[model samples]
Target chain A: MKQDSCQVTVIDRKRIELARKQMPGAEVLENVSEVLKLLGDTTRLRILLALATTELCVCDLAALLEMTSSAISHQLRLLRARGIVKYRKEGKIVYYSLDDPQVQSLIKVSMDQIG
Target chain B: MKQDSCQVTVIDRKRIELARKQMPGAEVLENVSEVLKLLGDTTRLRILLALATTELCVCDLAALLEMTSSAISHQLRLLRARGIVKYRKEGKIVYYSLDDPQVQSLIKVSMDQIG
Candidate 1:
């Protein structure tokens, strides 16, 4: 395919360099990638959106999104492993919520932009 | 597998609800998911970071990242299709850069948090 030539004004070039310089550490890239990967999936995104509204157990999440509990469990496991979500035990039930405030804020900002 | 119980404090509940409400449009979710999915890959993420610093054509991007031109081309195609990156043609070379300021800002903020 024919590619178009792009021009980089001095200002944008400086901005890009600043962005790269400001990027977090190697470990942070991994974590951010993990978080982004988790958010990449539609099912997972919806699950997160639902959870963003309320702390729900696997079953409740499944019910709200009309997905299977097994699927929700699998996605939740991914999110939990990435530290994007945390869970607590109440008897035999497991309720889950955002692991960090940053996660909520990131989602909020993205939502605000898109909304 | 046994799941852990999670507790939802009122504050968190309110925050989550607010996040859900604030999330952009269904279209933005699709777009965000597209962008995130593109960034989810290590190769693509590295490419974006590199491009985030400078406007580079396929050749420069491939050379800087030490990847094949073919690979860079493919990834750039995805970025361009999603409006994450735009390119202009100058002779036989095509230069690519970020399509929107939001992308740069988002990357910067994420890097800041993790850094």
Candidate 2:
């Protein structure tokens, strides 16, 4: 029996050429990374998770995370800027929630994959 | 009618206090990030997608992507390190495939979310 070890690595020129033409470009990857990186953190992930399950005001998130409302506000600011979450102002009381359905789906999938 | 802007923001001490006890910690978020980051890249995501559909050797991937086998190997190395993908040997020919079902699920969710 002969193993491929001694043989030269095979090059599927046609396939490789076709893929180079078909694969996505830098812009798409960069965009995807931005979204994932936002979800990559402990605080943000928790914030997003909490929001996904239910809309909450800053005080609510602060209470849940045991963090300062100031701290929670800072993270929420980032999430809002990226369009990952959205807020509705009802007077001084602003409630936040996941802005995109994809965000919720992505998080659910993330949980399933890790589990 | 007075908007809450001029008023002191209300803090739901009871709700906030309760939530702090329920949320997750740093460890879980960090672990989830690891998986998401691997899929964050364009090339790696592409590789994972290819493998998810069909197992292929390095050369097959290289051919399909129109990349040098060396470039493909480098990406595969990163994916393997993260446990995102795996490979088997047939002589010198090593074939690769995704190691977990979660990877596929995550990608699908990502696509749906982004789409």
Candidate 3:
């Protein structure tokens, strides 16, 4: 009742303050959430997992995922937009890899945890 | 033309084989995606971030996030089902924290990557 009635209900100020102080800024939190959300997709995640191990051209990714190069390229475009994956152009081939080293850690850590 | 007409178009067999070899099993990838999906929500992620720093009860989380205990409990249930966070009952209070160490790493690694 008190909690409902009160404009401000402080259950544990220490925790409130602690969580507040340690909380990453709003932008960072938003970016982190966005990154996680983007990583949440199955096909995209599969591509990332593959790239985490080594660089892959669209055709290679398509072969590995049993999909088409066009399909793989579409998802890779989304990943590239989010800055999660980057590509290198060598002649007519474009190879993609995880843009951030910490991304590999994120995947490895999450996979290890799941295992 | 060659790629489209053929059911199997091998761009670079070596890269595909390497990716397939390094790819995690299907279940692990699914679970990892599920975990990341669970973590993709803002409220759930905020709760996890708080717990990553220290343990907190539903009341504490609600108060800190400025939400009702019932709302906090609902999200906590989802998080619990996914095993991203765990809780212990003490008296009338239930304290929650991240279930897996690598979850902390996942968050930390992502945050670092974003930075």
Candidate 4:
């Protein structure tokens, strides 16, 4: 396949170096990648969007999205593990919400653009 | 495997109804998922971060990320198709940058939260 690159090989070392310096470190990038990957799924994204309005337990999410509670909870576990979502206990019931405001804004910004 | 859901089966119909009404449409959620999935890759995310500073050609992205121009171009094509990134022609050289301000903010928000 023909590579999608510039025919000329002029390397702007200074600009590239500046961007590299400004970029977050490897560990941070990895964490961000993991977060985005989790959010990429339709089910998970829907769950986050629903949770954005208010916290919901697995049953609530499943009912809202029309999926099984097992599937919703499975995704919630992954979200919690990644720190994208947090759970609180009220008696025997558990509610899950977005852990980071930044993530909430990420969804909001994305929705505004496409919606 | 055991499910990770609340044992209780009390569905808050009112809350779920409210959340469902407040959520974005299915099309928007799918679009957001596609965008997040694209950003989920480290190389693609790094390319976006670099472009966030300024536009660059595939060769420039390759040099910055230590990847081949072909690989960079491939990801760039995918990003362009999804409207996440845009490219312009300067003589014989082509430069790519984030296509939407919303996408730019998404990256910024993600960076601020995790960085």
Cα lDDT tens digits for candidate 2, A1-115 = 2122333244544544454564456666567767877777778888888876677898777666667778889999999998989999999889998888777778887876773
Candidate 2 residue lDDT tens string, B19-105: 555555567667887777777666677787667667788877765555677888999998898787889999988989888777777
Model 1 DockQ, alpha carbons vs. true complex: 0.20
Per-candidate RMSD vs. true structure? 7.7, 6.8, 3.2, 5.1
Can you give the lDDT of residue A7 in candidate 2?
32
Query: TM-score of model 2 relative to the true fold?
Result: 0.70
Candidate with better TM-score, 2 vs 4:
4
Ranking by DockQ: 3, 4, 2, 1
Q: With candidate 2 superimposed using the best TM-score fit, by how many Å does residue B100's alpha carbon deviate from the native?
A: 0.9
lDDT of 3 by residue, B1-115 (tens): 2353336466677777787888878888888898888777778888988998789988888887778888899999998887778999999888898887777777777777764
Q: Judging by DockQ against the true structure, name the best candidate.
A: 3
Give a tens-digit lDDT track for model 1, residues A43-70.
Answer: 7787777777777776666555556678
| Pairs in steric clash, model 3 | none
Worst 10 residues of 2 chain B by lDDT: B1-10
Q: What is the alpha-carbon lDDT for the whole of candidate 2?
A: 0.72
Q: Ignoring the other chain, what TM-score does chain B have in each prediction?
A: 0.72, 0.76, 0.77, 0.79
Cα-based lDDT at residue A25, candidate 3: 76
Docking class of 2: acceptable
How high is each candidate's TM-score?
Answer: 0.76, 0.70, 0.81, 0.83
| DockQ of model 4, rounded to 2 decimals | 0.44
Query: Once superposed on the true structure, which residue ranges of model 4 sit more than 4 Å away at CA?
Result: A1-10, A89-92, B1-10, B90-92
